[model samples]
Target: MASAVSENPFGRSITTEDIVDTLGFFDSWEDRYKYIIDLGKELPAMPDELKTEDRLIRGCQSQVWLEPSEQDGYFEFQADSDAFIVKGLLGVILSAYNHKRAGEILDFDIDSYFDELDLMRHLSPTRGNGLRAMVQRIREIAGE
Candidate 1:
């Protein structure tokens, strides 16, 4: 695994730089979707043990599990979902916030980032709501 430095000037685990780099690699939203799905493939699968009640994310139509761990003073997240789109959304969240301190992740300007990417407006209402739920669950884990 490629390790990112723990302290980032941007105060985000995954910077706008990372997202820009990712976007540059794909030619179209279809290709981007493929890349996003591929990112989901890279997520460490949530353990069956962690799939109990405590890890479940509320407000999601699918069964979503998120397990957070702190290593080397950085928070790392492992997540999974039974639904494909939810899995992809989890990938998006992980790409942005995994491997950061709780404070940094909590401080990240996520709405601005999503607006810059033109993401939420393009999504269906349900998917957008589910995305917000995912972010909320992660933020809650960060204790924000």
Candidate 2:
């Protein structure tokens, strides 16, 4: 069984609230995008072995790998994307859903959360679709 780092790369702990607050601090969308990419940079590396086709997420314009594990009844996910911005998006998704129980994850209003972040409107159609696909994949895993 593989385990992931509890903390993101920056040493400081990251949480969904923290991302929301930080994103709110930036006035321009350009700045926000940069911030998101920075967050992506902070995501820990996924082992090459874990990047198999079975772990590849479909619908993304870039290649994405997701591997999930349950620990003590909570789910933890490890993900990586070939594109910088996509990786950042993965970081955002992980912040919202990681270390949560299946019921909790199911209960989460992801659309509302994305609305609060003002995220979806800015994304390209393909990216938006891919995002939904990733969420759906995670939900399916949790359901199982």
Candidate 3:
């Protein structure tokens, strides 16, 4: 049988640099938020069949699912969220982590990236926690 991971053929072409540059162009947080939501809108829809229980992210306030696979030492993740902002947050995280080599993903300074985006301060405590949870999970997967 073909692996479930093969079913997604997932790709996240956006980069963290693109997000920082775009977010910088916005003069206000509201505009930045709109851009973020738009980014979420661009994410290819994760099919409902892939949104299985084992894929669900545990710490998020909204329902989030992630399907991960490794091919030739690079990781590809297909993820979805029930909330718009959460989806946007997933976009940010995926932009950094998806399709990256395990070493690359593990080496990335995610906190610094978040600081450059000025992200965590703008988020609610719960949301911030969820974002961290997502990162931690991805990092864990990479470490394995």
Query: What shift in Å separates residue 33 of candidate 2 from its native position after superposition?
Result: 0.5
Question: 106 in model 3: Cα distance from truth in Å?
Answer: 0.7
The local lDDT score (0 to 100) that residue 82 gets in candidate 1 is: 87
For model 3 the local lDDT of residue 16 reads 86
Model 1 CA lDDT for position 75: 77
lDDT of 3: 0.85
* Model 2 lDDT tens row, 1-144: 112334332333466777888999999999999999998899889999999999999998899999998877778888999999999998888877787778777877888879989999999999999999899999999889
Candidate with more favorable, higher lDDT: 1 or 3: 3
Q: C-alpha displacement of 53 in model 1, angstroms?
A: 2.5
- Looking at candidate 2, the ten consecutive residues that score lowest on lDDT are 1-10
- TM-score of every model versus the real structure: 0.81, 0.90, 0.90
Q: Per lDDT, what order, best first?
A: 3, 2, 1
Candidate 2 ranges with C-alpha deviation above 4 Å: 1-13
- The stretch of ten residues in a row with the least summed lDDT in candidate 3 is 1-10
lDDT of 3 by residue, 46-113 (tens): 99999999998889999999988888777988889999999988888888887777878888899999
Candidate 1 Cα errors over 4 Å, as ranges: 1-16, 25-27
